[model samples]
Target: MKKGTLYLIAILWAVIVILPFLWALRISLIPTYTTFVSFFPKSLSELSLVNYEYLLFKTKFPRWMINSVLVSGGATFLNVLACSMLGYVLARKRLPGSNVIFTLVLALLMVPYHILVIALYLGLSKVKLTNTLFGVILPLSANPFGVFLMRQYITMIPREYEEAALVDGCSRIGALFKIVLPQALPAVGILTVTMFMETWNNFILPLVMLTKDSMKTVTVGIADLAFQTLNTNWGVLMAGSLLGAVPTVLVFVLFNRYFLRGLTLHGGLK
Candidate 1:
């Protein structure tokens, strides 16, 4: 293709990718009738902040947003810590049954979470974790995929690093905290963003676990607004949805380099 043609194709691709989101932004700023109207507004003469104001003021959006932030943040933190440590074991120490344990961890990647939901509910009920924030956060934090990803990254590192640290009088914990953890920064950053978004976007788990409105995340809160908001308040709901997606997108944009680095390096090695 000609260079002009290639440029044209790229521009068209960009437009196609961005069109839906732009339409959504327009709809969010427009009135709710636009939801069913099948067309953009006739009166571009005036735009209103009515929906934004309603979404922000009249709803429990702030509380739900805070709830999502806490759960996702906490879960991502826990996941990074746990996954990195477990990954160190899977990568370095080759004990008996270690392969089986690692294989089982990888096997969990194939297990549909929905299949485990009922069992998790029963287990949590035994521990009185039902209808709580911890209920929402716990299931998302124990990330097998993060462990796998980190293990791949760790296996690429030279064994000399760990051994040298050990020779310098560092215990396993100290070596991990001082050496391996620093080396796993790229994987940690990727896991942080991915796990945070997973927990933030997850509604089914929270819906199953939390019966109370006060513990809802943004996803569950949006569903509530969709059903209970008299149907015409979709503009308000869209505004909330747009706002809810911002943090995840922002974090990804900022930390995307780390995600790319980890995956690329891991893939290059094995």
Candidate 2:
């Protein structure tokens, strides 16, 4: 490709990736009632802080955000920890039904979560755990994708490390903490980012699992705002959407290097 063509392609890609965000930012800056009147504000003078102020003062946005951070962070930590342990065991330890278990794990990944959500909902409801954080966290703690990611990555780790740790008088648990986990941080970072993003944006799970306003996360809160206003305030909605999306974007921005490196770090140890 020619240099000019390459530059054009780069520009096109940048525009494709950034245009939606730019539009959101532009709308976020526009005054509420007039913001819907024109794509570009009628004049430079029409912009207002109303969206931000309204979001802060009128909505449960801050509370929703706090709930989001807690839910996403807690879910991410538990899911990653459980997945890591399960992955490590499945990769390194040979049990009687290991092959059968592995096969089932892969097959379950083929199954749609929505199809299973109903049954899980009923079960949780029966246990009186529905409409709660534990309701959200328990079901997600054993994520199939996380299990597979950890399994594949763990297989890349060498047996030598575990052997060495054993020789150093470390128990299996100690070796996992000291030797295996440190090396797995890149994978952990990737998992954390993935889990956080998913939980942060999770609409259905939270909708089904949490009823209280205080327990609702950002996505659902924003959705409720955008639900059935007689006159939809596109500007305010866009602003809320942008705010809802910011944390995931920030996580990706800060740890994206880790995520990319994690993509290549598989199969290193084995």
Candidate 3:
């Protein structure tokens, strides 16, 4: 009876989560002028791709897509690489005042990121990067959470492996690449997905930093389309949102196994 009830609850929760996407998809397919009471279209004749057509051909959405990809990809790559290397160093190296540095990193994790936005904007503006993709990427690329997460994962690795590599004439950097990193791929994959998703979905920073229509990221671009003073395109907005979600979804799905492994926090070889 308990198992049956759990299954029932799971099904309900899944439906609750998926229902919004299904509704948006339905709205995307149905003609903008028509209203239907049911969950699905009334007939095949009522379905249309006009929203997608407008979204692709008539809007600056393609540019937004490109900008989003470049910015998100750049940010994720730098973040994962820097965090992993820093994490490995912090885990393996015992430099003077390292504990104080780690404590500062932990303290940073407690502070909300939004509090830094104004200061970041002012600083980036001074460097003439206010309207650039690099501005978006630079400010966000070295967050403490990624560093903390990677450090935690690296600590789980047995030091004996690094010791063995060192005895074989491997330098600290060499062992990081050949020994520690290879073992940390699962954690890295999870961090990549996380950083990519966060950067891709980031709205406020890009909205503030980028002034030109050509430089707008997808999230900001979609908001522009949705909030137009005249002829607001609800159908196109919904379609764009659904399509915009594809890459993040694909990243998670493609790295599903690694993501799960990262979450499980598996330790080094027995």
Model 1 C-alpha RMSD to native: 3.2
Best-to-worst ranking by TM-score: 3, 2, 1
Q: Could you say which candidate leads in TM-score?
A: 3
Better of 2 and 3 by TM-score: 3
- lDDT agreement of model 1 with the native: 0.81
Q: Tell me the tens digit of each residue's lDDT in model 1 across 121-209.
A: 99998899987888767878878888888888899888798799899888998988888888877677777777777788787888888
Clashes of each: 0, 6, 0
Clashing pairs in 3: none
* Residue-by-residue lDDT tens digits, candidate 3, 25-76: 9888765745544777678887899999998999999999999999999999
lDDT score at residue 129, model 2, on the 0-100 scale: 87
Please provide TM-scores, in order, for all candidate models, with all chains considered together.
0.87, 0.88, 0.89
Least accurate stretch of 10 residues (summed lDDT) in model 3? Answer: 261-270
- Per-model CA lDDT versus the true structure: 0.81, 0.80, 0.85
The alpha-carbon deviation from the true structure for residue 92 of candidate 3, after best TM-score superposition, in angstroms, is: 1.3
lDDT top scorer: 3
Ranked candidates (lDDT, high to low): 3, 1, 2
**Model 3 TM-score (2 dp):** 0.89
What's the lDDT of the predicted structure labeled candidate 2? 0.80
